[model samples]
Target: MVEKKYDVTIVGAGPAGCSAAFFLAKNGFKVLLADKTTFPRDKICGDGISSAALNILKEMEVLKKIESIDHHKIGYVKISSPNGRMMTGRYPIVKNFRDYGYVVKRKEFDYVLFEHVKALPNVHVLENFRVENLVYNKDKVTGVAGSHGEEKIDVFSDYIIGADGVHSKIAKKIGLFNDKNKHRAFAVRGYFEDVQDLSDAVEIHYDSQVMPGYCWIFPTGKTSANVGVGVFNRFNETKEAKELFDLFVRNNKYAKKKLKNAKMKGPLKGFPLTLGSFGSKRSSGNVLLIGDAASFIDPLTGEGIYYALLSGKFAAEAIKKGEPNRLAGEYYEKMWAKKFKNREFMPGYLLQTLMGSRIAINAAVFIGSVSKKRATNMAGVISHVLPKYKMIF
Candidate 1:
């Protein structure tokens, strides 16, 4: 067994963990950033990086690396209703922020951030480390114990951050696991080459076959995309996600047209999403959760990268400069509430619930297609580039 000590032990080296590690290392903290996989590995995702997420990436100083890569820049969005009504418009622009977003494969995106963090002086980057449990000092989490190949490793830290995705071992060890399907969704994605009519716009198609969810065609190039479908776990309990995906590719009017001549470039991958419900137990004692572990994914568009990066920043802030009188967990909860979870975002959640019905989605798409302003508003809200209230007003 090998023992180590650090100011913080992050259980995952994905966006959230890397974000936290970057900030903490810059502040001279001894940080241990570990992951079960090696660098440049593929993560199952839609690969759509929101403008909001790009803001954080810029701060991390890794955005330039991503910009230098051959990535798709999304300037527009196209959304279609179940009955085939469609709205296509430019993404709404805000002052000082570019209207366009990017779609880079996770292998590249995650690796860029990981490389940036791994170079920091105070951070220890561990690959192929699988966390199995938490070490407790009389009920207060004090460290983490995991395996690295054949070696057992134990790390002591002041705080343990679970940035390890939805099925986080740290989250479960801290008793925050919930079985409710209301806050969960299932998504499957596959890359396709030569997808026809692929534009700079990210496309989302709604249908009765996958209500409470949508299928997305996020272009990765001029003629290819990461195409996928997401359905609420509750709605998907009796359904097969792969079947739903095949049906969307072969039957959904818009998707069929775009994918009719497309060739699948890889295997279909499926994963669970912890939708942003906000009420999940985010922190306890000296342990905190971020990203998917905290259920920060958007309920409407099934986007998590923005929230993941933002939550990582918040977690780092809480640990580095939190009030001395308050627990870091308490400060983290406050920061998360102020930044990501609040009353202002409630309308979006309500809309996500309403989106379960085919009639509601069709009506909304019809309204959006009526005018350019309406279309822009629809795209902005759905992409989380604008507040939900803006769409209603």
Candidate 2:
């Protein structure tokens, strides 16, 4: 057995973990980053990066690298109603900055981020390791016990950060995953190559019959795109995601034509999408949770990459400014509330109301058409921007 110590030990080298490691190591912390899987692991996602994520990447000096990669610039979002009515809106990423987001393969993106973290002098990356359990003493998490291949190892750290995905073992072990409200949706995603007639735009189709959730097509290039469907778990009792997705593809004329000769290049993967105000209590003793471990995904849209990065950075900042025990508890509670508390509540309420009635959707579109600014304000609410009541009404 080998024993080592670190100022902070992060489990799961996903976007959140890597972001945290970068900040922590850069700040002179002796950081240890470990992951069960190797680098360049594939993730099932729509591959759409939002402006918030772009800003964070720019701050980290990774935006230029991301732009150098093969990606498509998305300027507008076209949303379709269940009745075949369509509404289009532009989300300009603000002037003098990346005006729009990009769509890229997670394998490439995650690999780049992990590589950057590994380059940091104060960071040590242990690959091919699974954290089996946390070693706690007197109600404080002090270390983790795990195995790398056949060798057992113990890593002692002053603080532990759980950046693992939705099915977080740390959250479960600490009794945070037992909450009922934390369960959001079941999602299936994949990519298609040789797609045709694609533009620098993302399409979101909201058809109750085809998908209770939304079906998205994010263009990655001229002839390829990332296509996926997310179905709320409550809607899955009577529907299968794959069947609905296939039906959606057959029904949508554009989707049918573009994917006519396209082939699925990867295996379809399914994962749980945590929505709204769910997850275990984020801060407890010496352990902190970030990203999907805290259930930060938007209930309506199923977008989480931005929040994941935000939470990861917040966790690191908290650890840097405060002592281990105090920081772990304070960071989890304050950051969780400041960044995500309002975001979690409003979306679920708005989505439940909108999706429950066709009349409301029509009314919303009517209001949007009559007043673009107001509509934009209404849209901002779902986008986590607080809007005046007059704008939405």
Candidate 3:
């Protein structure tokens, strides 16, 4: 496209980027969606796709494409308290979306999303294009500067959408990075086969050692599953998340039983997660941040995909109704708040803050282990069918 100025430029071709590009181009706007890597690349994630995210894909006519790929359906969720008490419940339908969750590697899921957005004739996608700098003119973001192959490529656009993820260059460049350990989580994930009790249901374990974080076994099928553990970085400072994961799998009685004769299929990978919903400026000047770049991962569930899709579509709506050069940043924030942020934001933030301690987690486990209603209510919280405050012990 050369120096041809476009209506919108999106960095990072993940779900959020593709979602933004999807709407912008469908509306007949010239758009560019660029990523640092090519398709089928592995993205470290829980591999749990909630019904909320699936509904968005269905609305976009892309859910069927995702379903055609290798995946597993989740109808049950089992949560193990730190004291070894287990609670299992059914997934709840939220906002008309089915209760079933889907388990597919982010690598596979992202490929379908990227490919769908890449097909729009009006949307140009550049893989292996790493964004290194933001193009600025008089303190307003005009475009981006990056390298493709051995050559530098620069493009100008009226608006920039930062979907580049947690370590986003655009978010950092615009001074939106909030560096607080309490607001972040570090975790490791790996694939495993031959695990016992393999089912479509996803299981989460809360070991006393990994308080405020968790270990999960989300099945991808009847045989293989994504298994791993995460820990709140602040409380888990000296402990390697991988080592903790191993400790759980090797020592936790239930984990040991389930992992008996299990073989890890791949190397354990780690990723940083931004948690909680803080009242921060999501847009500044002509640039807006969505998805992980905006820190929308759920504090309780550690789910980001649903929020990413939510933010991307809401952002597109804001951009669609605004004047180009003078689009109001506050308008974008207000729109995001009304769509999904206002009702859910404060509660998520408060939950994260409260759960950061060891006492709350232990107490919840103690209470949840004895109360069937409490366990079911917690499942509702996970499904986002019930308010987060319901599970607060």
Candidate 4:
């Protein structure tokens, strides 16, 4: 097979890859976005996109398309403590900010991304093609070897991006996948139809039965919702995510109330969630990683799409600075850290640690209910609408 040359090659066609390709293409870089599966595929997630993620989509010029689809505009997150005490952290009305989040199926959300990126003149998208191996010259990644259907294709590029996801082949091949299981979280999500009392607010329940874990019900459509459960691996104790979600739905009181008339739209699906490890590495040689491949998911809310798009755009900006061949990984790492570490993940880690105790969660609910500003700030920080340091300093 002839090795085709391009300016940049990105693995994975999800939010990260597509965002990176779109930016790079607009900046006049010849880009290739490759993925193993076709669009409209499902990935296990909470299915909630914060307003920040939507703002990025607006910048990409695809927000209108997503808006035309059937989805719910989430305005706030309603929190129910283990003792059934409910409190809402409504997104504060920031001046000129779109004060709403979105809950759309990954099927529709990701398809819009793929279609938008594919229309770029300098961008080529390869679906159902997996990056089989990273082409390297003794640790310096030059490009990739991929399998599209039955044919093997070799593609060469000056820069490589591993946006493939948690099970990224590029990350593993580049020796970036250190097993930090303690830093990982596990979760399961599924769609349900005929759900009763489907509210515009995304509801999260913290039951004592699932300590260090929470169940979320996000309305995706008028009668359907995406329901899921999440538990930090540190306290997971070998419990199956699917079984845990089932038990929660059957047992949790508030869940029973809300889901009384709801029927499961599909079987519960589970997936591994990689968390951001502050001060951890995210690049090597001529390659940089983004999204789940770089463990950019928020530690508290599991909002990967926000970081995925941000990191992709940041990587493209860093690549734009590389004039004489390829950009070094350190530049990408530094850029990612400057933007996300102190500003994004630290507050998430703090809140995640605090939520470990049922008492702490109850206290938070009480305080947030009485103090509206504090509540909005806390909610804003978690939802990525406000800076994390707002809660700290």
Candidate 5:
């Protein structure tokens, strides 16, 4: 048995955990980043990165490394309705700047980020370690006990960060997993090869019949793309996701035509899409939750990578500046409220409304059709900041 102490012990080496380690280690804090899996592990994701996320990547200096791998410069977004209405918005790349977003393989992206963080002097990476329990003193967390291979290790840290994705053991152990307002969606996604007629724009098809959530086709290059559909799990309790996916691909015009002759290159996998924040009571004692452990995924689009990165940074910043007694919990709560609380709640509210009425969906589609700029603005409002819209007509 080996015992170690760190300023921060982060569970999960996904985007959020790695980003937190990167920022904290750069600031001279000792960080231990642990994950159950090794590098280049596949993650189930939409593989789309937004402009806001790109800015964070640039700041972290992993943008060049990402570019060296297999990626595609996404120039625009195509939103399609079931009734054949479509709208396209272009995100142009500025001079001396990379494009707004890129489609990347999570294996490569996570590996690059982990490598960068592991190179830091004050950081130690423990791979293939499963965190079994959190050692607590009364209500305050003091450390985590787990095993690396056949050896047992207990790591004591000033703070613990849980970035371990949707099924976070840390979150479950501390009684932070709540399903009160939690809307769970099941998504089946995979990569494909030899896909033709795919545009540079990421295409999203909204058809209520085949899939309640959106069907997305994101291009990674000329001959390959990431294609998938996300559906409300409650709707598929008795149904098979594969059957639904096949029916969707066979019947939908866009899916049928686009993936007509494409070959599925990888295994189709499913994962839980968590919606909304972890409430105001997510933090307890010295244990703080970030990323999926904190339920930071967007309810509407199911995009979480950006929120994950943002929350990770905020958590690391809190640990770096805040005092252990009074500031740890306060700092965690304040930072989450200031940065992500609104963004998480807005989409949940809007999705609830949209899910309740077809008229509302029609109205949304109508508004988007009337003005792409306004719709984009509306998306920005719900996803980033809420804006006041006064009807002129």
Candidate 6:
């Protein structure tokens, strides 16, 4: 058995885990950042990153690095309603953030972040480390026990930051995961080549069959795109993800026409989304959940990377306040609550439920089709460039 210790142990080296490790290591804290997979592993996603994520990438000095690589810049968005009405608009310009977004494969994006964090002096990077259990001192978490290949590893820390995805073992061990259908979703994605009429604008289709969810076509290159379909778990019980994906590509009018000549480059992959909901307990004892483990995904847009990165920043900030054993979890809870309060007070969960109704989707799309300003506003809200309150007001 290999024994290790650190000031903080972050499970899962995706965006959230990497962000936490980066910030903590920069602040001179020794951190053990572990992940089950190796670098450059493919993560199933729509591959669209908005301004919310860009703002932090800029702070991390990763934006410039990402720009140097091959990526598609998105300046506009197109929304198609269940009624077949479509509207297109530009991403609203926001202060302190870029007006446009980018689409890069998770395999590429996550690898860059992993490389950046590994170079830090106070960070130890562990690959292929699968956490199997949380070591608890009575009630409070003290460490984690997992396996690296055939070797057993036990890592102790003063605080545990669970940045792992939906099925986080730490969360389950701490009994914080809700696992309710209402707060969960599933999505399937595939890389497509020779997609006809690929554009810089990302496409979101709200077909009736996939109500409460949507289909996305995000361009990655001139002839290649990341195409997928996502559905709330509550409504996805009857069909497999692959079936929904097929239906979206062959039935949705615009998607059918655009994907007619496209060929899937690889097998379709699916992942579960732990959609964010208010009033959930995010922290207990010395463990705090961030990113998908904290359920930070947007209910309407299915966006998690931005919240994951943002929550990671908040977690590091809270831990830096001293007495992490006593105050870190409390600080994290309060900080994230205040920062994400908009989801409860604004049109976040409300809009998601309303969107499930065909009448609501059609009405909104019809209004957007007739009014360019309204279309822009809707796009802004969906892309998270503008607040949802602005659209309603």
- Candidate lDDT scores, in order, read 0.85, 0.75, 0.82, 0.84, 0.75, 0.86
lDDT of 2 by residue, 190-229 (tens): 7889998888778877765664567888898888888877
- Which lDDT tens digits does candidate 5 get at residues 185-225? 77888888888788777887776555455678889888888
Cα deviation in Å at residue 263, candidate 2? 2.6
Clashing pairs in 1: none
Least accurate 10 contiguous residues by lDDT in model 2: 382-391
RMSD of 6: 1.6
lDDT measured at residue 333 in model 3 versus the true structure, 0 to 100: 85
Task: Give per-residue CA lDDT, model 4, range 169-280, as digits (tens).
Answer: 8889878874587668888888888888777788888887776798888999877889899988866768777777888899988778778888887777888888887866
Worst 10 residues of 5 by lDDT: 384-393
Off by over 4 Å in 4: 389-393
Worst 10 residues of 6 by lDDT: 339-348
Top-scoring candidate (lDDT): 6
Provide the TM-score for each candidate, comma-separated: 0.96, 0.91, 0.94, 0.96, 0.91, 0.96
Better model by lDDT, 2 or 4?
Answer: 4
Residue 174: error of model 5 in Å? 1.4
User: Candidate 3's residue-wise lDDT over 286-328, tens digit each?
Assistant: 8998999888788767888988887888778778877654664
Candidate 6 local accuracy as lDDT? 0.86
Across 1-393, the per-residue lDDT of candidate 1 in tens digits comes to 788999999999999999989888887779999999899888899999988788888999899998998799998888888888898877888765668899999998888889989999999999999999999888777899999999999999888999999898888888886546888888999999988998889999886666656899999999989999988876558777788898888889888888888899979999999877766659997788998888888877888998889888888888876545537888898888876777423565787777777888888778788888988887776556788766656
RMSD of each: 1.5, 2.6, 2.1, 1.6, 3.0, 1.6
lDDT score at residue 331, model 3, on the 0-100 scale: 72
